[model samples]
Target: MRTYLDYNATAPLRPEARAAMIAAMDVVGNPSSVHAEGRAALGIVQTARARVAAAVGCQEAEVVFTSGATEAAGVLDGFGDVQVAPTAHDALWAHHRRSEKGASIYAMGVANSETGILSDLPKRDEAGWHAPEGTADFLMLDVTQALGRIPFAFSWSGADLAVCSAHKLGGPKGVGALILRRGLDVEPLSLGGGQEMGRRSGTENVIGIAGFGAAVEAAMRDLAEGQWQRVEKLRNILETSLEARANKTIFVGKAESRLPNTSCFITAGWKGETQVMQMDLAGFAISAGSACSSGKVRESRVLRAMGFDASQAASAVRVSLGPETTEDEVLRFVQAWLGKEEKFRARSAA
Candidate 1:
């Protein structure tokens, strides 16, 4: 049986989400139309907007639906003076670009992929341009990796804007949200007949939105029920096993507060792609660093930014779990991995 473990890339559709999408597919009406049919579509879109808004603990009006997190981050360009975590998804990379020279550049640092490291912003700013006691428009958090697994509130975090992907939390792929604090002007990325409150204009994907809503509902329920505890247990088991068998392996991004499902590490003398391929051949799927560049042959920038040497950076791999992962799977992977390591060592000696 094939084991799918690459959750950081994308999650499988939840059953509730699939059912919701299937049901919504039957409703044939353009949300923008003023007729009864159009009104029905509009109602569906509004209901989804409310559900998604509630999921993130924000007002429905604050949530602007987008094609995905990439587009969501793109919207942040309208707001000048952007600050992002160096560990943020590539979508937020544009924050590095500013119209004027010497603009504030803040690259928040995280501890690890799974265990998020909180930035020492106050410490990092001891010299000048301090974020006033509790004010400033200098932050836009990319919550794509932190959402669902962590209890993050945009309002509480002091972020002016936040981006989250639905699929990361078992939602549909084609839908995401760009949440901006009140009064922050975000110019539209796509223009046409005004939709998404004149922010994103296009034909609405009612079915995908419905599924996205259901998935968010499920994730929220899971979070409330302490379901992450189980995943954390599996994660620890994997880490312990790695420690027992690998001598030079080291975990990366050990954040003080991170998404519980993520764990990135590097093993000396072994390339990440080779390990990933071997894992896949053994019926387990894992990522060689970020899945965003899974096919590309390059060292992980995140590791290099953290000061790892080129070889260690090239050796990093990410083993992200999901809500569906089981303890048995972790045990099996550990056992299989230990056996592989012994064989490789013997071959090296010969």
Candidate 2:
């Protein structure tokens, strides 16, 4: 039987999300129209928007719906001087300005998608300078991986802006949002009939947005019930078992605060790509690094930024579990992986 453990890449859609989307499929009118059917469609959009706001801990008016996180990254495109964390995801890092000028905007992710390492969120100073002042120095959080897996509230994160994707939290893939601090204006990337409070312009994806709301609400419930803590225990068990068998394996961020379900480990001389293939053949799903880079065979930029050499970076693989993952499944994966490790060591000795 195949086991799926690549939640950092994308979560399996939650039943709540599925049901919401199916119900939204019948929304026939355009939300922008003034007709009765249009008002019903608008109601769905507004309800979903409110759900997203509650989950994010932000005012409902601050949430601007977008196609996905990649498009949401456009908030930085208009700025000529910006700094991005070395380990930031490509969506944000792609906007990095390398001209050696001082930055007025900084972009960083609260959690590393590959290693699952958690980072401190920005805090406002006494002068309220934490929020960007007229495109001046400020912080933007990429909350994609951290939103559902951990406890975070944009209302108090001290960040000027944040971006997240619905799929990362078991919602439909095509919808996402940009959380803008109240009273901070940003030029719209796509200009048309002023929707999303005139911050984003486009016909709403009714089905996807409904799914996103349902998923976020469900994720919030799981967090309140301590479901992630159980996942953490299983992850620790998996790591402990692997360490006993593969003495040379390096578990990244083992001592650091991290997402409960993620484990990134490096086995020198054993390519991560190869391990992923081997594990896939052994009936498990995992990843070498971020899922965004498809058909590319390069060392992980995230690890390299953290001072790992090319060899170590290329040798890393990530295993991320879901709330539904059972201890038995993780143990089975551990056995299959250790078997491959032994064979790889023997081949190197030979």
lDDT at 163 for candidate 1? Answer: 74
Q: Estimate the TM-score of every prediction.
A: 0.89, 0.95
lDDT of 2 by residue, 272-300 (tens): 99999999999999998634566575789
Q: lDDT of all the models against the reference?
A: 0.73, 0.88
Tens-digit per-residue lDDT, 90-129, candidate 1 = 6676555544533343334222342334444433233433
- The per-prediction tally of clashing pairs is 13, 0
How high is the lDDT of residue 111 in model 1? 27
Which 10-residue span in candidate 2 carries the lowest summed lDDT? 127-136
| lDDT score, candidate 1, position 328 | 88
